[model samples]
Target: MIIAKIALELTDLLVCAGVFLVGSVISFFLFHVALRRKREKLISEAEAEAEVLRKEKILQAKEKFFQLKAEHEKYIGEKNNKITQSENR
Candidate 1:
């Protein structure tokens, strides 16, 4: 009878252990899913910021190009005026 009682106790212990193991596995899966979502959000935000920076850089470059073009045209105009004056003299 004592042996039967011990066997029953052992079975109960094993069942409890199995329950604990299953709970742990479920928790681990939930934690991993949450972390994956967080990582994706961070990556998306970084990509958006990078796109904004790229657009700003392009706009700055275009503005600089226009300024340089205007300066070049002014220089050419001045040179032409000087040559014409000298030829008239």
Candidate 2:
């Protein structure tokens, strides 16, 4: 009778331990998935912001190039006018 009682207690202990182990594994798996998704979202947002900044820089560069081109053309026109007046005189 004592041996039977000991066996029942051991069986109960094994069952409880099994349940606890399964619960821990499931919780860890879910936590890992949640963290990975959060990381991906933050990376996507950062990449989008970087792309927008790059486009803005490109636009500013194009504007500066056009402004410089205009200024250079105006200077050449003034120089040609002066040369023509001197030749005429």
The TM-score values for the models, in the order shown, are 0.87, 0.81
Q: By summed lDDT, which 10 consecutive residues of candidate 2 come out lowest?
A: 1-10
Instruction: Predict model 2's lDDT versus the native.
Output: 0.99
lDDT, candidate 1, 21-55, per-residue tens: 99999999999999999999999999999999999
Could you tell me the lDDT of residue 37 within candidate 2?
Answer: 100
lDDT tens per residue, model 2, 26-52: 999999999999999999999999999
Index of the highest-lDDT prediction: 1
Give the clashing pairs for model 2. Answer: none
